[model samples]
Target: MAHVGVVGPSSADQRELDDAESLGQGLAQRGHVVVCGGLGGVMAAVSRGAAQSGGVVVGLLPGTDRSAANPHVTVTIPTGLGELRNALLVRSCDVVVSVGGSWGTLSEVALAVRTGVPVVALRGWPLPGDPAMHAVDSVGEALRTVDALVRTDD
Candidate 1:
């Protein structure tokens, strides 16, 4: 199973939250691990979905408090790195699925691409063309792209 990181803003809109949750559920049902910043908004929603589906979720928290993680996170690692924890989250995943947009999400996507990790963006930023990155409109498309990128042997 692949380690899939889902990144978005702490203050996300309804659409982004819904999409992130559904993507998390689908990824979990498919046996992939869910990784996130381990706070609110997209991170919380995704963790809830994956946990509800009986999937393992790894929350790389930005602060030193493990209690700062969402209730659904199965594993919480308090990095205390602030925004720099984004790099740790990206590195922990085989591929990242970005739901919606934010400066923080943009940074994660950029890091993943520059480091040769594939990214599947769901209604994310308008980034420069990169072979490792692709913008998708729906969660199904994102899952398909993820399945193709994350090999079974990994």
Candidate 2:
């Protein structure tokens, strides 16, 4: 299965969290693994959505304590690197999905683009002026872009 990293605000409004959850559910339903920062807000919501869909969710946590991880996370990797853990999250995925705007999310998008990894932005995320950066308005379009970038063998 393709591994899609979801980057967004850890503390977001309800609407943003809802959007992230929807995108996560869509990705999981399509048989993709969801990865996130494993904190709260968008990350927790996305993990919850993906797990509810019976998909594997990996969380690259920023702190040493895995207890801080959300309940939806299936696998927790405690980096203890704080924001520097963002690079691991970006590199570990086949495609990156940005749900809401935040500095951390923006860093992931930039790193993904710089590393030649495909990125699908849902509800408008900053692009790095790269052709691999896809700005999709809906979750469906984001899913389509992800599928196109990371083809499934089965």
RMSD (CA, angstroms), candidate 1: 1.1
Q: How many clashing residue pairs appear in each of the predictions shown?
A: 0, 0
Model 2: per-residue Cα lDDT over 1-154, one tens digit each: 7889998888898877888888889889988989999999899999999998998999999999999999999999989999899998998989999986877788888888889888888875555567878898877787888888887423
lDDT of 2 at 29: 94
TM-score of 2: 0.93
Where model 1 places Cα greater than 4 Å from the true spot, the runs are: 152-154
Give all TM-scores, in the order shown: 0.97, 0.93
lDDT of each: 0.93, 0.87
Q: Which one wins on lDDT? A: 1
lDDT of 2: 0.87
